[model samples]
Target chain A: MSTVQITRLSMPKWGLSMTEGTVVQWLVEEGTILEQGDEVIEVESEKINNAVESPAPGVLRRQVAKEGDVVPVGGLLGVIADAEVPDSEIDAFVEEFEATFVPEEEEAAGPEPEKVEIGGKSIQYLKMGESDATPLVLIHGFGGDINIWVFNQETLSTERPVYALDLPGHGGSVKDVGSGDLDSFAGIVAGFLDAMGIEKAHLAGHSMGGAVAAAIAIQHPERVASVTLIASAGLGEEINSDYIEGFIAANRRREMKRVLGTLFANPDLVTRQLVNDVLAYKRLDGVDEALRAVADSLFPDGKQANVLDISRIQAPVLVIWGDKDEVVPASHAQNASSGAKVETIENAGHSVQMEAAGKVNRLISGFLDEAES
Target chain B: MARRITFMQAINEALAQEMERDETVVVFGEDNAGGAGAPGEDDAWGGVMGVTKGLYGKYPGRVLDTPISESAFVGAAAGAAASGLRPVAELMFVDFFGVCMDQIYNQAAKFRYMFGGKAVTPMVIRTMFGAGIRAAAQHSQSLYPIFTHIPGLKVVVPSNPYDAKGLMIASIRDDDPVIFFENKVLYSVEGDVPEESYEIPLGEAEYVREGDDVTIVAIGRMVSMAEQAADALEDEGVECEIVDPRTTSPLDEEAIYESVENTGRLVVVDESNPRCSLASDIAALVAQNCFDHLKAAPRMVTAPHTPPPFSPALEDLYVPDPERVAAAVRETLGTSDRARA
Candidate 1:
């Protein structure tokens, strides 16, 4: 094999169902050095408008997918290499790559999320990177599922196995939220870990998921090696109750679109796909009741019903918050114990993992690595 | 452009387009994938009625075929939706809702309100309804009113292929739990449906035909009857406005009120039994909201309060037809009054 350092800027899959996306703009021109995680190109999928950061540190050699070009998932979008790489080789590589790239059969064959029976309910989960290393289980907050980790899961899984779960009453997991409480959800998570045969895991949660993770750390400490909280609830006394209530009550497109806007700092992140997705979920049979129970039991008003003391957490804790989080207040981070290495991300909101995946991933990976060491 | 496709095809196309546009949209029901088991023709039956045909081949695992357990799969669809998936569960027939209504009425409906407005359960339950096809009582019934009675649920009864495709697409994309009732008899009735994905906002009424003499608001299959009545009425010099309220839960009260406001005479046509049917509902709405707009008391043309007869002649008579609809409109605008004056 010829030793040639190459950067594969393939079409980015922002979410599970995004088979194609349009290149919105390129922030950096060709022939520029890009450190890993550096923003290079911004892309717009049906569900989100996200910036594709450099996966590896290298020179951005060529701009393959120009602005406004819609490319299929796995399609070659660009290339990166050291300045020493021959121009002729780069040209030949691009030609060969384009010639051989076959858009997978139009038969809808893509990543298949699996559902396993955990605690007498169907648990939907997406697992990536088949490493024997301790798996990282991502649990999303209220009204969220594995799709919320679409950006972070694939990136973080490169070093170790990563699994994103749709907690009960969320995602493809069971809708029967037995108690519709944090403890009930924690039990379900622990049961899922047991069913997956995972002895220990780095648990990461967003919003209400943070409380679920905290509950797990307190009750089933042995199963959790570390914890990462992103814009989590249960940390503060204040939450945007209006947003929650509006999200639950808004059934029409205009109403739902307006309600979902409150989750992000930019508000633009609540794309049409996101609204449609949330609406589709809301139409399911028992989902509404389960959601209502969770909402009433967890956060009755603007205040969180289940607040766990992070200082009592046995595992190493890493609390990540968006400085401008609108749904969950950013000041909640101050309540976290000083022992917990808390990082408040700027220009991010409640969905820090999606808004600033690169920064959040590095923080998560660094914390996970430290725990393993 | 409008093209002819089976009712099943219309539902399938609606689902396929919606899923393509929205990744969170998913489809699951009994035998939705067809040949999940057995040796011959792995993709055996797309569905019992084959309405979901070809979708399995196109969407693969997303078009899930569940066990005959409606409660389990329906509840699972609801559960999956609460978590992340925007699942569309097929009940096969509205009559089978008895086995799994708790998921729809209690669970899916209550999510938004009971959650203190923190939960959004965007889901759709599509089922075949109405009398015809010799499917008998168990398979045939107009149950939209039952669903419409529920505050949280949005009940949809598409009148034709165009409405079927657009309304089904809208139901899939809608944020609330919508009971999309497809008339089994009208599935084969072809009409224009746009290939590109578009949503016809729920609770909006469609003016099938404009008229000056009398306003005839119809539901589901009866809208076609009313349209035919309007065509016949046009030849007789009596114009009639035909309105189709695609959804009943988010009832187009404004549409009914507006038509009444304009025509000053109303005739509501419904295929369901007269008592407590969409006809009565519309009449009550007009009386309560647009009472001053009426030139005469509103008239309701509907099937008598009785189980649909199996005899073709009786069944045909039992359902509201163009003649009955035209007569109701004529009564609302009596030519004798003009002749006498």
Candidate 2:
């Protein structure tokens, strides 16, 4: 018999505020051989419901947490090991791991999102990981905040520093979107990089943020290293005007839930907490005017207003589109320049990064590796 | 970014933001601007405790400093509100309501009804109450029950900084008269508050902690005390569901009844005196609405029927603590009876 390695599958911290999660169901049972990035179990928090992916290739040995049992962050959920490992040794490993486990209090406290003033506006951003690698800055879509990257930010931060920023009129940032056009939005992103003392960095933007990223590449090409657009706008001239109107008009939970359902392929992703968070953001003092201004400037007469000339971008570009996207159609992926690589993800919607986070993360990591080399 | 701030700071922010947003919004009270006409300096005190400090300089003439007369200023506030200005009048201490009872109950509160629904009196009476500091009998008193008893008035007693900010904004924007009660002891307590303005609707109860064994309803500062008791009870395998009714006038009756029906046991923690207070009011509510589902008689943890004591030691015993609240929960569960026997 050979020595076996056991991998403890623990509950993950999805966002800054998540303290515990309930195991809704197990997608893969004990003794099932799992590959890395394969779906292992489905977990539900107050914010959203997403499937937990396997971190390593192994055989599932024990399901420690039962279905419907709520487990605190960092609590053990299951164990994965080589199939050749004896049952006695696996049991001993589980016992010893449980006996020695101590939760980190500081991790529970977590780091608060920091705010910086750029051009007289308060911009809030959350930074994770610390490395000398060229940093990646994440800009959220219209009516969204840094929280839209709740699934990808922490994972992407493992290799290098990742900064997820709340643009003007979103999240904890100042609710003043000056001009509310692509140029102004991109200028703020450039200002954010300047405030953070970052000379040049990779930009990953979603939805309207994608247009902003493209604008940054066009206007301030010196500040951008590469660009990644996910379900981005400005690629074509057609948008679902009803979604924008509904989101801006939604005030109550029920109306907000209906509006947010358009973002995800599975409407169940729009939980009550999600709807409440959006409502809270919308209720902020200047959010209504800011959102209206952006919508009017970007989507006029139910069509995309600013179509970017992507061929002028000097940096390498990766454009991701969800085949099932209702907001921006998948057909727009063809509009990318010949130099840009476009990948269309299936079974996802406008929120493809959250719905298919594993695939998206792998794609981004590989693209970043290639770009750096 | 969202950051932790004291309950007092939250109130100040609400006032500042509302005044900045609406030109019709005005603030006035005794010493709200500190040195109104003193020989030393301008904008002197900013109120008894510095809750309204720095606003006088920011708003110029909007933040006013008035004489220490509750009846006159409160009445003036009602008049100004009815005449198209939104005024937030600070009553200094809630115990002084005796001097201003007529203005609050008769005029401001009844304006909309008296004027055949045409009058929109947008007035907020901000007052300090509760016992914690050695304030003695004259200053510290929870008189929310009196305001809650009024038909046309909306009484709000927020427990933390987040609720304090939200409820204050809601009160300022409300078309009717609102009595915004601030607990003196809780002024320094800190909680996370968002920088941007948001309003928590009145008449909704927030479930602070969810459980299944016993339902604990708390009001004002007592909400924190009940939360502490609930956490301790969890250690002994007794789960408690804690609810905070942010407003007393627009009481969330359905939440209380649903919680009582689910848990079958109820415990109410109120810092006010035992008789004719929020404790008795909620106990009567649960007993009447969920009588068939109740497993045991509802219990109330409150101060005895007397004035707030002056001495620190006596005052410590006068207020309801976590132990008292936990003991009351145990009593409702019949576990305390076993210990007594």
Candidate 3:
């Protein structure tokens, strides 16, 4: 609606719980031209640190927030406009935006994660941005919770409803994963959709949850619109058993930190709070037994017990993996059917969804848009 | 969602949760159930600081109010623990431990070894310690180092609410007799604690802050002081890594050793007197094991070797503060303001 295009690249609200973020440093300076998805600034919340990307193609006109300054969610970080835009106009724009901007209140109205009993198992999920359009379902890997989508869920839910869930034996869900195999988990997720009254959804899963999504598409083809797998299992025969065994045996924060380091290419991403959180989860009652059962059933004898046929999938499929993935090989993406699309992100590991969320979200968004059309 | 509660509330929650899980667990102290049958308010004081306040109403018969004889009740706790009840007896003040030392150091500690490993004294003696309340010489003392000297006894001194809950649960479930020390000053200190029961394994140290310039190993309430020092030190272009050894008996020597070796400098901050305290213990550990890695003599900041004073000003000066700890850090780094002058 404006004759002069101006974009406010404010602080991104990564998850439901994040109220503010401190600007660590700016990667790109003002007056530099930026592409749609270039890394512009590094911001850190209490949970983790990540770089904020550009919203659109423009010349960064002014850096509004200084490094080390704490800014509330949606507060302005920098202004983006064309080079031909006058300085007076840009200043007016910045002044007008800050004058009208109000950070969110204490999150009383923000979305919250809810629990649903699926086949007598409590599964916690966060639902965002409701619409009649085909909903998108997010599935976390083994030993993960609904918080894994701290970077993906909110952005993907802008148009269609997105649901991120904690599988059995993880997060706030019941720490009872009966049999803890691919098909049992698949059935639980299928029942979860039924409990939520979601008829069909575009399913996306990471790591162990990927196998669950693929199994759903294979067994209950009617409930799946499309399938997206990120460094997924069920298509491959090999998994890093050391990481599996180490995760179950690491009861202390120091050992847990070393174990979580293998998940990311940049081990520095593994913060003290992350390790403490994982340790807290593992220390809960019955969680140790649940993880053991899941590991024994899923990765028996240091190898995947059941490798599904990705060829049997009826829904459109998109396979994404980090080229540097150490836990599960990226070469497994080669197993995708000719009809499916595959992508491998460079310099990311098994946790490609979290390490490179912006790129993964863009890829999934583009794939889902094409599939829906 | 993260819910912030006080350290006292955390300990109470841990007791409630463990009692709910294991029916054999029982709680008794001088005023834990202030007045049981002959009182207007059933759950009166909770304890001296209300740490066990409401448990009597929930589990009436289980929570008992003991007579003010520490030796008698403590010996009874040891007997109850050996006879099958996992009793958590509160020693009102650690200063009273002299009367119950034989029961703790001899009878309860040697059971498993003396009984050919067949017997276990699963007991926890929760007591209050520290000098900030101006309780004078008799009531205020940092005596955890004394318990750490005894065998077959686990010593836990938690610094915050989260650790308070986890360490309390762990101490309750431990097979050995555990001496759980709570600082009266930290009763109202708040931190995020989960509602569910969890355990932080004994002998593991928490890295409160990770830095490369120096290592500060602070015990109990000194952990927060070291954190404050680290923050001020950070502004001066010095990064200090802080290590909180949650348990003094089963010390994580490896963590302390590795941290000191990495930074090549150490400062041990303990609220106890310097002689044979955790500060000296850790300093000696690093000196013996990490000698080749040392860049300077390890400095220690501790209270003077004297009975705590009743004068408010002297008592305030008696306890270690952030400025003293930061000064010790600067002394080790050779960046002291005096050195600059």
Candidate 4:
């Protein structure tokens, strides 16, 4: 008799903040064969829902964790082994694994988001990965903070250092928006780079942040290496005035749910936790005034107030949009500079980066590679 | 950005931010600023556990280190509040309340009523309580009930770091005297807390877990224990709704009544002794308000009528555990308790 090899399928850490996940369902059953990259199970974390893929090809020996079980990250969810393995051997392996398995303390301190004062205002940012490659800077859209990049930051940082920043009026940054105009917001982005001593780097912006990025590329082209815009705002004249007004006016939970429903093509993606987070942020003092100032300055009569001439942008640009986006139409993708490459994702809404994370990540990575070469 | 911090750190941040925001706010307690007159470090010990450690240096003259005389300082805090300053006096251990009962209950708690509503005692008494860490009988007691028993006093018992920070800020800003109880065992427990100061209003009951079968109303550290029990019961197809009444005085009776009416079953897990406790109070409230809605007699899981013991084995039995809470919930569901027996 020959011994068989075995592999344990454990819950994966999808992002920096995910400490545990609830097993939603098992896509594969026991005694079934699986190939690498096959979706084996569905897991739901507080932030997002994603499927766990198999790491190696094998027969599904046993499902150690049942559906609906909330297991800590790295806890064994199932076992995969060659068909030659005896049931007795699999049982022994699982027994030993369970006896020695100690869940890591979820609250163990990790790299924390830091704050720096620039121009007498506090700016919050998170820096991940360490590489000599040109650093990537992420700027969030209107009413968003660094958290909007939660899905893309860790993945992109693997090959190069990445910094996700909260503009003055968002996230943990100071709530005061000095002028709430593209020039004022863009100047703060430049000041952030100067504060960090980064002379030039790639800039990726979403929605309103895209406008800030375009403004920087136009006025201070020497500081920008490349630009990637997701459902950008500066290239078009038409804007969803209803979304702007609804987002600012909605204070109750039900109202918030309705307003946030516009951000996703599948409204089911809007969970209770997401609504609670937005409400908590809005309740903070000075946030209301800051948001109102930005909205009044940028979108005066339900229209884009700072539409930029995309043809004059000097940096290599990549434009990505969601075909079903309701906030900013996908038609705006055609307005990009002739040199820009454009891609529109189907079955996604305004939050294309989050709705189609894998595709967006691949597209951005490919664009960055070409720009670097 | 929100970051994980210990319960003690949250309290400290709340005090520091409140003091910075309002010059009228001042902190004074025994060893809140250690080595006040000694030749060594001036701010050596922030408190017994250093909950107020760095505030002395930040505010300079605002944070004071008082002698071990609780009555004098507590009375002085009340007098200072009446005179205009919002004083937050630490009682060190709530067991020491005997020495300062007159100052807290008679003077501070009754001033507004006796002075034709002209007096405003904006004072806070922060103290540590609860049995754990082997801190014998006198040092460990869940005495928030005693404070909650008094009229004109707002009692706050926060379970996690987020609630601790918010409740502390609200207490400091409140115009009435407030008693803030800290569970010593929960000092090191961590949770996500916002860097910016925010206030959670008094008398709001937070539904920690939403379910349909039973409503579990818990207080202070017991909230975490009830959550643990709720998770375990979930596997057995027993769903539970857990509620944390952040404030004992001005209790959110409406939240409890609504949850109990929906679930039709009630189980209260409290760390204090069973006699005349918050558990008994809440159970009574539910029985009176939702009598027709209940499916079974309300169950209470609490420490025995005796004081907290000293031996580790006995202390383990003294504190309510998740197993005991689950058994009580099962009893309310008319399930057999013979399995545990």
lDDT of 2 by residue, A1-373 (tens): 5667888888888888887888889998799999988889989887888888888899988999888677888889998899888888888877997898886564476657999998999889999989999999999999999999998999899888899999888888888888888888888899989988898899999999998999999898888889999999989998999999999988755678788889988888776678767876787767888999989988988888999988889999999988889999989889999999899988898999988888888888889888889
Q: What is the CA-based DockQ of model 3?
A: 0.55
Decreasing TM-score order of the candidates = 3, 2, 4, 1
Stretches of model 1 off by over 4 angstroms after superposition = A1-6, A83-89, A107-111, B1-201, B204-341
C-alpha lDDT (0 to 100) for residue B116 of candidate 2:
100
Q: Per-residue lDDT for B328 in model 4?
A: 89
User: Judged by lDDT, which candidate is best?
Assistant: 3
In angstroms, how far off is B112's CA in candidate 1? 27
State the weakest 10-residue window (summed lDDT) of model 3 chain B: B332-341
Candidates 1 onward: DockQ, in order: 0.05, 0.36, 0.55, 0.18
Every candidate's lDDT: 0.82, 0.88, 0.90, 0.88
Candidate 4 lDDT tens digits, B262-321: 888899988888888998999999999999998889999999999899988898899999
Query: Tens-digit lDDT track for model 1 on A56-158?
Result: 9889999999886778988888898888998888898899998899875543654578889886788888888888898999999888888888789988988
User: By TM-score, how accurate is candidate 1?
Assistant: 0.58
What's the best-to-worst order under lDDT?
3, 2, 4, 1
State the displacement of the C-alpha of residue A210, model 1, in Å, after optimal TM-score superposition: 0.8
For residues B51-70, write the lDDT of model 1, one tens digit per residue.
77777767757888788888
True contacts kept of each: 0.06, 0.53, 0.76, 0.18
Give the TM-score of chain A in candidate 4. 0.86
